[model samples]
Target: MSGVTRDDRVHVLGIRHHGPGSARAVATALAELNPQIVLIEGPPELDAVAPLAAAQGMRPPVAGLVYAVDAPSTANFYPMAVFSPEWVALRWALDHGREVRFLDLPANVSLVLADEEESEAPMDPIRTLAEAAGFDDPERWWEDAVELRYHGLDIFHAVLDAMHTLREGHVPDLRTRRREAAMRRVLRAALRSEASTIAVVCGAWHAPVLVPSAFPTQAADSALLKNLRTTKVAATWVPWTSTRLARMSGYGAGIESPGWYHHLFTARDQVVGRWLVRVAHLLRREHLDVSSAAVIEAVRLAQALSVLRNRPHPGLPEVLESCQAVLCGGSDVPMRLVARKLLVGDILGGVPRETPMVPLARDLDATRKRLRLKQSAAQQDLDLDLRTQSHLDRSKLFHRLLLLEVPWAESAETSRTKGTFRESWTLEWKPELEVALIEASGFGTTIPSAATAVVAQRTAEADIAELSTLVETTLTADLPVALSGVLAALDERAARQHDITRLMAAVEPMARVRRYGNVRRADTELVQRVLTGIVTRITVGLPAACTAVDEEAGRELRELIDGVQRGIGLLDQRELRAVWLSALRSVADRLGVPGIIAGRAVRLLLDAGLLDVTDAGGRLSRQLSMASDATQAAGWLEGFLSGEAALLVHEPELLEIVDQWATGVDAELFDHLLPLLRRTFAEFTATERRDIGLRVKRIDRGAGASGIRSDDTTLDHERASLVVPGILELLR
Candidate 1:
């Protein structure tokens, strides 16, 4: 062997990452071995900062980061948890004053390999072996193989044998070969040193290959890493979280249940009792009913399940099953709460003040602190009523972060379906957001400036719709600095684009922002100015645009005109409104214009009082004449009177014209018009429809021919007075 001696052979402590049992075994084995040096599998580039893991107030669920010196965004994380075997091993070395080093392939090469190969490795021997053994869950198999069975130094030997057996005919991919070769090279160099006793800890899958007999020669391993492309890299440590660890985020070697493992690792006695107690605590906070009796039953159930499953101690599965059956009453709602809040806790870890971060990340952190917002691995719900200053500030911060493309918070919807007063957000902080924040440093130093820069950058390619959306986002974020630039972009896009539909689509959103600004008390004067210009253009082009089209185009233009009309109503300027209404009146008068649009124009004119009651009745009579096809006339009527039932109810002449049209239509034409009539009537409330029906019935009976009477003679005062006493008695 390259650096082997029979008297003091190097020990390979095989371990499962983040496994409590493995962690315990590693601590015990390291204590007994008393090695002068301990080498752990991590980015070798991060060896100098490995001691940070043991610093005062340092906690686990922390990660050692290594990134390109020139490009901080290109980084990798080797996360550590308190229950992690490697973490325990590192702490052991620190306490014992033993030299420790990270021995994996350097992060520069690994990051490149990772970026190049975005897909997961096709070969996963551990998962394959678990599947072949009829274990549907690989975590269960790992628990049985290592966590449940392994103890003392015996585990080391068992792991090596199992790994060797699995790799008897296995072939590694090129990336794996390079990685293993690097690990081997580091071990050989460590062994060749002056240290007498050395303990090497690594993944169980790599333990067998670390042996000198099974590993490649030192010279061969060196050749594979020599003349490699490399980048200057920096290393540091950052805080992580238990929820992130349990969820595994995207780490390949993550534990299935970090919370369960933590319980196993920390609780000295009454393991089931502690877990159930935590569950009860979580349930109580949510105002759910849980009691001591339930806890006792749960403990008993867990024990019984452990016995039934033939486990040496109650595992997570047993506890979960027991929790589901007894405490949950077979309901998953309370159980899910326990699983998320307790199993995957909301505990967030923090790094020391000395830790390094890019300028943007530092600013972001400062803002988070200022807003009293916590960074959690688990998703959290934030309900903000923009009426409050603090809530508005928080909202602006989230929007700015979004503009930077660092999705720490996302715009979500609240249960309140009716207004803009409330805003809901789902906040989840990922480690990679740190990298993204670092990348965004080139934009600006502060959140507002960076957001402004981002908007400016997007303006180069954004179309009118996109610019309009940006405008709304900017207004909501209260980024006044970015607003001018975004509006300029929108103006530029609008000037270049002549598509009326697109222009009209842009109009409504601007009007919405302007109106909402009134509620938020934001200065919407700029939006108003831009909206005026858009309305002017739309009005100038609309008369010509409304004429001569097919059914689909006609329908589309009608909808667009309707939206533009609604938007015109939102504008406070009378001149712009006058121009828009004039264009609509012209479209209504033009014979070539489609009946649907003409109907809408007439409705707008009537609503604006440009058309009198007499004019509206005449227009209705003309539109519903027998000369027009039933379908076309029905479409016009639907466009004109569908939404305003009062127009049909109060305007007797208009109602008579509609009645005549309906009565005069032949059976086949009536069939064709049935759907359109149904759709129109569907818009009216039951009372309005009932009143209209009664009017028609009265007209049919010649009861309304005499017109409405206001005389009290027809209503007998004596008879009515007699009924009042009975009505009063019934009320009492």
Candidate 2:
């Protein structure tokens, strides 16, 4: 059977999605046929915004986004590159004053229907044809036969014929049947309209069934689509990227090499040569030493390989292979870069400012422009100094976006010593974030308002830990209105919460807000009062919480204790430090407390200068006594040496005590405790461990009798005097 059935008023041009050769052929045939109306394979709801495709600032490689109005997450993107046949058809019709409309299953119906049980996957017609043609790779076969070569409008007829044969004995699933029925309904409507001539641009697979003779009756088509569940949907234009167009990005109808297809569609002559020159330039930009001679060699090799493969011109594979051999010196490293920068490409499309958008998206666009922050598909690092107004505003925007789940910018690690004024972020904008912005619009119109609304809603069900984190997040985002709700929730949760661990988790984040709130010029008086109350409750409950804990629980409690200590340090409040230290002492003195907890308490006391070196050494000796249980002793050592292992290197008395206790343990006990000992010492730095070992050896040889040598303590006074005279001279 032939592909077209003697329809003089209408022409069905079947083309591949995003296929450049098909695009060229469609444009050529449209000029020749000059149809009065154009129908493309996309969601019909997008017809309202389809004219934006020809807008002045609307660049190619964008997508028409259709989503359920209530459930914005249930969405679909009909992406179009400059070379996509559908895009060409739409632009041509719009430019020439011809009517254009999308003729596929509306996303509103399709999104709801997608929840139904899916049928088994159908056979791949392209793969079947490729296998019949003795090609294993379907993409290569299609590119070689149709995309790389131009056969005018006859190619579409051939594609339609192949698809018809493929469908001869094959049965389509319910979804496909429904979709095809929907397309036929639109075609019937177009036929009944006043338009004298119509051109239908659709996927090659659907073309065979769209012919007038093959189309099912309108009543049958309507019956197939009757009572299908659907929702209210909205459509808009959004920027897209070539990287997202690649098959690797999970687009079902994606092409493998969008960059190569783009080259084929846009370049006027010497496509292979220009592609290689582009590759060479990319490699050179990466500091690879590619020269003109290498580019020439690569082009020659690609042409020769194409001739051997009997191709009309050099394809992507031939050019890539030539690049690997000649330009990259047979290394794949530089070639991988070439594949990313030149093969798949990092091209991000643009949409016109006048294009319709949700309020949230419009606000964000304006905000981005005002902040002088350009959206980019490529990853970029943004360093912000919170002291600067512009940087602070940018930081607030990023934090707000994160709250709304946009995550266009992710917080990266910055140096603590860089102080509270510095923040680092990694920013890379993806097209899908537009959908997120739209979804967030339901919360509020602007970024801050939306983020605050989300946080305030979450605060109702948030636990103490989440409330604490929310408090910090609100403070960081400078959301004063949201911060009030979070702080109230935190205070209420802390008051009723009896879980000491939960209370402890709240301390650090609240402390952080109090410590760093000034850097952002945020009000922290409320946070300070809530934190003080939480600390008081923690001090009351901590000693009892530390009692009767198992080894694992002890370790976890130890970490909480460490965090609390750090939080107290951040506060730097004299009265608060005293109360916290008193609580730690009580835990240390309490009988039946886990040795790990007691040991960490004592170590914290020593670090806080509440206990002297002699007291700490005596406590260590008692803990590691042979009379003590070996396992408990090991736990004590692990906890005591947890963070400050370098103390053993600096303090000879503690090191000597630990050394003697370890050597005095019985062999069986030693074997039992070896893993624990290894684990504890493993936490120590290599240099710390080495220094401790040397100190232990010196003690064994009687050189560290007083924890210091008398002669060394004499300090080489003559050498000190020599240094002092030089220091005085420099000062003078």
Question: Which candidate number would show the highest lDDT if scored against the true structure?
Answer: 2
Instruction: Please provide, for model 2 over 1-732, each residue's C-alpha lDDT reduced to its tens digit, 9 standing for 90 to 100.
Output: 454467457788987778787788799889977999999998899899988888889987898888888989888888899988889999999999999998987788888887874954544567678789876545557767765564656666778888888788877888888888999888888999988788899887888888888877888889989998889999898999988898522124777778888998898789889999898878878788988998999999999998998766677778889999999999999987887887788888999988989989999999999999988888899999999999999999999999999999998974443236888999998989998998899999999899999998999988998899899888888899999989888888788899999989888888888998889998899999999999999999999999998888998999999989988999899999999999999998898888888988988998889999899889889988889988998888887888867788888888888887887999988888887888888776776776776776577424543444234565687777877765333223
Q: For each candidate in the order shown, give its overall lDDT on alpha carbons.
A: 0.78, 0.85
Best by TM-score: 2
For model 2, where is the 10-residue window of minimal lDDT? 701-710
Q: State the TM-score for model 2.
A: 0.93
Q: Per-residue lDDT for 433-549 in model 1, tens only?
A: 777777788899888889888888887778887787788888877788778888987787777778767788787778878877865668988888887888778887888887887
Which residue pairs in candidate 1 collide?
none
Model 2, position 513: C-alpha lDDT score: 86
Cα deviation at 688, candidate 1, in Å, is 7.3
